[model samples]
Target: MDKLKINIAGLELKNPVMTASGTFGYGKEFSDFMDLSKIGGIFVKGTTLHERQGNPYPRMAETPSGMLNAVGLQNKGVDYFVSNIYPEIKDLDTNVIVNVSGSTIEDYAECAERLVGLDKIPAIELNISCPNVKEGGMAFGTCANSAANVVKAVRKVYPKTLIVKLSPNVTDITQIAKAVEGEGADCLSLINTLLGMAIDINKRKPILSTVTGGLSGACVKPVALRMVWQTYNAVNIPIIGMGGISCWEDAIEFILAGSSAIQIGTYNFIDPAISVKVAEGIKEYLDKHNISHVKDLIGQLSV
Candidate 1:
């Protein structure tokens, strides 16, 4: 039995370490730094039904112990990914999961449907964090009904594993989690960047182009862990916890909270090879504690 191996829904991961969407690019970008197959999976950058220019420049701002990004889900669209990016990553040794985003339910469904034919792609992280333009620009993940509707739509077209990435900007994260699970979401990856902002005192203006952006890094771990633990108790589905996970210890903390898997986001920029290091560290922690398998550690927090 591979000690570190675990299964999320039907998707098997060599370990719980995965690269967060938009942070690890398409896995190819990090090829020069680490062995792609060393980690469990890689969630590629966000993909949409149509090309997105993303937020204007000055979209990123650094804060104390964290950073805020309003880089809008800029991408060349799903068709371009199918035609251009898929072939390049289809043969990597690890799982190549796409992060699907859209402004509407139809866009989400259509974009997800495009990846159904690809043999190498095993799953997609449905990013409901994107604002639903048709619904007055409110994020779909912020509302239980809206979250369910999007997951329900994508579930009908996406036959493979569907992992919904929950937004931290919601009033109650678990409510959205249960709603999506009820609508057929296979797994959940939570605490997507918290809503935050930064101001340039000198310029007397907001640092980011969008005035506010998603806050990530070590600063958001406490909130992410709390939400993961809460959602774990509320839903039966496995949770893929993320947000401010920078090291193996942090990864282990998430596992104990309820994350069957964890993704490394902002920290990836600091260390290109951190994902593999995290996987190795997890294995070491398991050995030190005499834990036979990593799955045994899931949600085992004493509290």
Candidate 2:
């Protein structure tokens, strides 16, 4: 059989297909819908030190090719996750990753420290670039120094793989990527969500309560591909490319652009089975092209 396995930040995934945080709830929600074992990895919703109610209502709006969300990491917090949710999914078939978020550097470190010894949890994806929160979310991610500070602090406590999620609203994504890599980030996930908004002409006001929300879906694919390519060349660390990925073709595009793995988002709301289809589709394409290993396609793009 062709080897489809790939490693990112020391976490070895059976395949490159993964579910994006916020897009995939705590895994239990989708338990009846699909086989969790078939998935390569599952990045659970963003977890914080405390509970979050998220933004006001009207937090979502549909766009032409994508969707906008200002959910603002509305989760039950890490304490409940460890005490309650973790046990239920400790033995799943895939790599279960926690998408950790925080309002401050201490919050991030404290949360990481909490997950250090969990045998079932192998990694945590630091979501430093969430655009929905008004406070500390993307503030630490847009700049290199601030981003490094957060990673440096958490790196000291978090022993497992550290995946830093990056926001697309920046002057140069590579600078941020290199900065985090320098500070010892284990892996990178890019183009978290471009800041975008829509308006209701009849009401003469914004569609979302936050005025603006994160833009994700096929609309952001081209931009995501470019940033992934740039960051891949900028840092030696492997990248977990995501943003607007909805199909196997889109997944292969990320691999060619230099991502060791890919994440599926937004599309989850449309079809819960999309990720399974993507995983199967990728294998079919590889076999058709005589590619023996998925790694062979990484950065194989030709001009």
Candidate 3:
């Protein structure tokens, strides 16, 4: 048996390590730095139903132990992805998952329906973190009912594995987790960047163009781990934990906390080949502890 292999719904991963969307680009960008097939999967950048210009300049701000990003899910739209990006990444050796985002339920469903015909794409991470313009710009993942509605709509059209990416900005992360699971989400990945901001004391102004952005990196791991553990206990579906995961030890902690898989986000900018290193480190950790398979380590925290 492959010790590191695990299954997320029906999508099989060689290991529990995957590069987070928007961080790893389309996997092709990191091919020269590390073997694309060495890791379990690669979630391409966020794709929307329509093209977006994204936030204005200075949308990114570096923080103390993390960073704030208001990239705004900028992409060339789903149709462009189907026509151009898909062909370029359809043949990679590893699982190529797309991270789908939209401003409305219809947009989410239509975008997901476009990817259904692609043979190489195995799964999609539904990013409910985007603002719902029709609903007064509130994020769909922030409300249980709103989260369920979006997942329910996407589920109707997306027949393959559906992984809902939960937002950390919610009052209760588990509530949203259960809501989506009830609506047919195959898996969950949390806690998407925490709401945060930065200041330029000298200029007496906000750092990011949007004044506030999503906080990520080592600073958010504790919150991510806690949320993952909570959601793991709340829902029966698998959880893909991510936030501040930067190393193998961090990845292992997430697994013990309840993540069947973990994604490396902000840290990817620091080390282009970190995903493969984390995978190797995980295998070594398993060997050292006499753990026969990585699955045995899932939610194995002693509490």
Candidate 4:
């Protein structure tokens, strides 16, 4: 099979398929279904400075082709992850990137500082696009200036690969992409679930308790591809593209659109091993087309 390896920041990945944050809990949960080390990397869940219980009971809602989640960044916090969880998973064969979700700028900075001295963590994914919280959640990513400030604050303390996760809920994603690139962001992950909702007409109530939630799955493929392609043109940093990627064709589209790598989100719920399958499928396509390195196809699309 053809090699499908790529680099994010300076770290090498076996293949370019990874699970998005929040969808895959720490690597432990997925190990039940398939080997934890099969995919390129496991992004794990979104962790903060404190443990979050998540939203109310109705934290998730199902749309026609996607799912909405208001699971408010529920995890055991940074200290616990470093102290308890890190020791257990440090020996895993794949790259372990800790995804950080914060409600304020200080929260993002503190999380980055705590992770910098920890040798086990190879990188940190700044989750600037969570729509559930009221304060500094998606607010930071929606505006270019705020997004740049968050990246700047984290850059001061963290010296490793810093991946800024972008939100799709904006007018011009290129504007925000340029803003973060100017402030020392090492890489970017795009189209983190579009804003959407579902309703129970008979019950006269909203599907999710939060009234609105972030939509992810097969339905969002086109929109996400467009955003990734646009951001790829706006910045030079490597982009980890995601949103509605479920098959090999979808994976090819993301690469042709100029993504250095791709992340699988809602597909994990349907098939726990989707990322692994995608990794193999990409290799097959590359071999059939006589393509060597996967990076050879990035941004090779015709307008």
TM-score of each: 0.99, 0.96, 0.99, 0.96
Candidate ranking under lDDT, highest first, comes to 3, 1, 2, 4
Write one digit per residue (lDDT tens) for candidate 3, span 75-184: 99999999999989999999999999999999999999999999999899999998899999999999999999999999999999999999999778889999999999
Predicted candidate 1: what Cα RMSD to the true structure? 0.9
Q: What TM-score number comes out for model 2?
A: 0.96
Count of backbone collisions within predicted model 2: 1
Off by over 4 Å in 1: none
Candidate 2 C-alpha error for residue 273, in Å = 1.0
Error of 3 at 189 (Å): 0.5
- Our model 4 lands, by Cα RMSD against the true structure, at 1.7
Poorest 10 consecutive residues by lDDT, candidate 4: 130-139
lDDT of each: 0.93, 0.89, 0.94, 0.87
**Would you give me the overall lDDT of model 4?**
0.87
- The reply for model 2, stretches above 4 Å from the true place, is 130-138
lDDT of candidate 4 over 1-303, digit per residue (tens) = 327767789877888889898888788788888876777888878889888888886989888899888887878899999899988888878888999888878888998799888786789999887432545345789989889988999999999999999999899999999999999999999888888888999999998898988899999989999999999998999999999999878888999998989999999999998888898889888889988888898889999
Alpha-carbon RMSD, candidate 3 = 0.8
Provide the clashing-pair count of each candidate structure: 0, 1, 0, 0
Q: Give candidate 3's error at residue 285 in angstroms.
A: 0.7
Residue-wise C-alpha lDDT for candidate 2, range 38-157, written one tens digit per residue: 778999999999998999989999998999999988999999999999999899889999999988888899998999988989999998874324443457889888889899999999
Structure candidate 1, residue pairs in collision? none
Instruction: Using TM-score as the measure, name the better of candidate 1 and candidate 2.
Output: 1
